[model samples]
Target: MNKKLIIGMILGAILGIFCILGARLRLPDHASFSYLLSFWYNRVILGVIIGLLPSLKSLKLSLLRGLLVGVFVSFAFYSATGFLDLMGFFAGFVYGVIIEFVLFKLNQMEKL
Candidate 1:
């Protein structure tokens, strides 16, 4: 197993747990944060995939993967809060794309 992937997963999980705790504590809800939490977690998970699998580096492939996870998270949030959060779904995609692009740039720099 790749160590970077393992570390990314652990870090993502920790971030997710902290997000939940923070939300429960009423310390600025998810909306108040402008879906950054959702964006970050989505990025972390997808970024790990990008790091581990080169095939997922394409923008189309990354967006598909991000959409799948984002919609799922949105649905989960709706179920838990009884309110749909489409912004989170969109933010997830944005962040996932951002991470992929950044990864692409880093790989390019590695070749230089």
Candidate 2:
């Protein structure tokens, strides 16, 4: 597996864990086990997408790529829930940038 893929997957899973907790805490009544699982998996997919997407020369462009992919991937679940989980949805955007930032840093380090 590519290092970026591994990194993204690991990061995604880590972020997913947090998402599960946040969902549980925020929507205690509505957050079912299956729902949480789906949420986690969705984040993992986001990581996969982030890992697979081509990197750009500009840091800003790369981060924007992450943001767009994050929003696109996250929108599926967001709409599925009828847009009830705003935090979860928005978290996707943040997580996307985080994943990209980590990968970008790694790339920079590699060039040194």
Q: Which predicted model would earn the best TM-score? A: 2
Compose the digit string of candidate 1's lDDT tens values, residues 1-112. Answer: 6644554455445545544554545434544454546534644665465446553446676556545654554455445545554444454455444544554455455521
Name every residue pair that clashes in candidate 2: none
- After superposing candidate 2 on the true structure, give the runs of residues whose Cα lies further than 4 Å from its correct spot: none
Best by lDDT: 2
Q: Where is the poorest 10-residue window by lDDT in model 1?
A: 103-112
Q: In lDDT terms, how accurate is model 2?
A: 0.89
lDDT of each: 0.50, 0.89
**What are the models' TM-scores?**
0.46, 0.94
Weakest lDDT window of 10 consecutive positions for candidate 2: 103-112
